[model samples]
Target: MAHDGSDRSGRTEIDHSRRRVLAASGIAIAGSVGVAGCLGDDAGDPFDDYGPQAAALESTAVSWDDLGDLEGELTIYSGRTRDQIDPLFEMIEDEYPDFTVEVDQDGNEDQLNSLREEGENSPADIFYTQSSGALAALKSDGLARELPEDITGAVDDDWSDPDGEWTGASGRVRAIMYDTDEFDGADLPEDIFAYAEDEQFQDVISTRPNSGTFRSFITAMIEMEGEDETRGWVSDMVNQQNATLYSSGSQQAEEVAYGDQDIGLGNQYYAGRILNEDPDATLDVAFTSDDPGCLFNVSGVAILSASDRPNLAAEFTRHILAAEGQEFFVDVNGEYPVIDGVEYVGDLPTVDEINPPSFDLNALGDVEAASDLLREEGMTV
Candidate 1:
């Protein structure tokens, strides 16, 4: 919305009182996230101090002791695949030899349900998810714990939890991907909703209504335009009769790039991957300009309340948020780094410039409402 890095999405801030209310009311939500394997044994100082107080305060600052003597195994559950985060696992293993991190990656909802069912016996030391929605679900169920104050000290208050249950890691913006041959750049819809109503986009647009991406977009609509408006938009999308509902953003982007569809809604990375694979492909990204439909989603890390290794788990979490670990995204995976100063090699838009309409809810944190909306609209998985 603005280049100042302030959340320009116009999202209304939830006062501490409301957050306490949610914490008390125990409303549940669900979604995806991932974890990585452990590596070598040379442990570094967790609190080596990056620099001045201001610099430390600007990042997810954490306290640390030598990981050399810490003896523990921290289990993590994630929705991100191994291929995407293996390097991170190796880094942790090599850097913190005394602490081993075990990773399990699966779909967002599946991982959350597993944690809930496991209860106190859950092996999960940390929980990582694709969106805030999943964390919200755990929070409602009394499964999430507050993050360490020092670890969260540097992140902007709005970007992190008041109680530190979860915070945005790296962010990806939602955008429209289209076959440039079929739809000229000039013909792209200015807003996301209009794409559903456009006659040419009829049957030509593909979507994943039940997936996390769609849920995030719909949640944003509900937050920005209210429930009625959001529902109306969904109805219009269905009326187009041209929309094909896939299971995920990557698949939808694949369909659009392969000429199976003219346009699709997806995270920038899906489209980026496609272009990287086929430079000759006719696919191109069209970020919404009207009310900017772009949505920012992240993979979050948090310590599970049931973990036996809270201190070690917290240290691992600190490592992930550290400058070196955050920059691993550029060298290892193509995904954006969660830490602020790291550079994102992908051609995605900066989070601040996206100018998406901010609403009262965290897009990922409102899964139940979104799930109900999708079901009410007859959009089953």
Candidate 2:
């Protein structure tokens, strides 16, 4: 199989439909908020700007105003891309003029290392990351503070830490993104391991071995199937089947849409993004029932234990779990809301409907072991 190296430079343009939906949801308060510049031509009434897609979504039960006033200075170490997270922070800033935020944007590994080095003196009040493994690592290292019941109770038990150290804000599932033009959804196997063992999929599936998401998937596999079995699967894919490599999940989804490959292993949101761009893109996402391929992971948030503004940090964390924050993730990032009653965009099933493998999310923190296995298999440099 040929290697099409990672394209880390390009950023996907924010879907306009998301903006319109957010506007109607009252999370985007265009004219009143500083985001008026980013959102062109406000329709005066936020509801007036929304299209049919926005109209279908029910209004969140708890609005930003319902969260009440938040006043303080909080710094965040965010692993999510600026394009994705900045708008949400901007909304928070606009809503609470007295509350200001400073975001340090970088890769998850880099941010985690920096926090460890800084120890008790780290300036970050919150650590918001795209990987559950990273959040679990923080909890294990004693860098995260226990969250309040109100915050942790908002999401399901599977989405939050058992000890209350961190809570998932939004959900993503591992999926097989395939071109509908080439194959029927029914033709795809429900077991993720089948992609390696089956001959029909050889040299036709693309994967991002270097992504943090992929690493977490491997970690879960190790916990469930043990290292040796996981190692054999990785070895077969890398050394025998010759799986193609891409730099990002989004790119893998795009290539599948273009018929460059029959299928690609990536998160569900990547396909949502492509469909958001063009609903007729000929790409659809499939899941592996009760398998690690359908791992339900989250982009989560945690209050740092060393923060001077613990009260303020807790409030901010709560805000992320609130209806407005949950809707922002669904509308803007195409992610599933971790909280109840917030509808996910597109025709995708709910988190419960996905029925992912049963495992402790915190157990996925052994990403070092996963990375080492990938290196041993020569899947990554």
Candidate 3:
């Protein structure tokens, strides 16, 4: 869908003025209201009525009430599938009759290429994608605009651009998906590198070289351990260890649960998805301590430099950072919320508890180098 060139003149002066004041004062309007106050009596208590999942939405910093009447047209070039992020836009559309969004969902690479090709004429107000590497790539290409301080301040600095180009909307940690029937979490190596060097893990662990998550992991490895070491690790896993390669993280999790493999390199949420489908699944997730295997990658959103409706785009981006938006990610996608105050819903430890090694997330932009190394090592097709 394309923007119809409609203006924001329909919004009330008070709504526009309120947002401006909040932005100027560096106040987070998204997190200012309570859930009950935002929902009102007719909507009732979401936490009490909607059960545990709804509880994640409670005490959120941002509410629909704070956003005011978000009336405008926005075109979002999303790397996440429609089922993953469209519902949030659906909620926004339902809440504000005047607001409408057009989502062009495609692969992250394709979307990034299109944004680059379109240049300043691109209709995309927002670029929502699955990896920080892609967001950084856009920023490096000068396709992204600096977000407002209020929006940037909502999330932790680690998950956002140091230059204020993009902000992480949700997070996932690299974890070892192991078969509960075969081994306990304690039995696994604490360091991810051990799987490549240790004989015990040989021919038992699975990985997805073609997966975006894996590429991002490799990118982090190259940044932290240097390219030579990172390339060697990939080579050892593929050649010496006889590591099995899967098509996707979910497949890796499923294979491990089925006992086809003792362990697999995947994301924490893949296991959460498995349990959600069948609580009795023989799968469990384990994390590596202070290693690249424990890399915390995020699916983030950015405002494009070519966007004409930056204010509306900022509001929508803020909506994703708000309490309800964060809750949707945790409750639906089994991902962690990037903002503070929103409680993590799953069995895994919170982001702070995971405490992934502090690396420059923006450095992940050079994913091409990681991919080249993977190909040179015969890791991908």
Inter-residue clash pairs, candidate 2: none
* Candidate 1 residue lDDT tens string, 1-381: 111123223322212332233224432100111122221222221322211211122343222221113345767888765545655666555545565666776778999989989998897878887766777677767887676665666455444566677765555667888888787866676777787676877777777786665687777777777889788777777765546778766678877878578878777778777775677788888788635277655666767878655655655666666544555553344355555555565554555655654432244575678789888887666
Please tell me which model should have the higher TM-score, number 1 or number 3: 3
Worst 10 residues of 2 by lDDT: 48-57
Please report, in order, the local distance difference test score of every candidate based on alpha carbons. Answer: 0.61, 0.76, 0.75
lDDT tens digits, residues 220-246, model 3? 898888999998899999899998988
Which residue window of length 10 is worst by lDDT in model 3? 48-57
In model 1, the runs with Cα more than 4 Å from the true position are 1-71, 94-98, 277-280, 289-292, 330-334, 359-363
Q: What does candidate 1 score on TM?
A: 0.76
Question: Tens digit of lDDT per residue, candidate 2, span 202-313?
Answer: 8887789888889999999988888898999999898788899888777788889985888899888888877877888988988899978999999899888877666666
TM-score, predicted candidate 2 vs. hidden true structure: 0.84
Query: Cα miss at 323, model 1 (Å)?
Result: 3.3
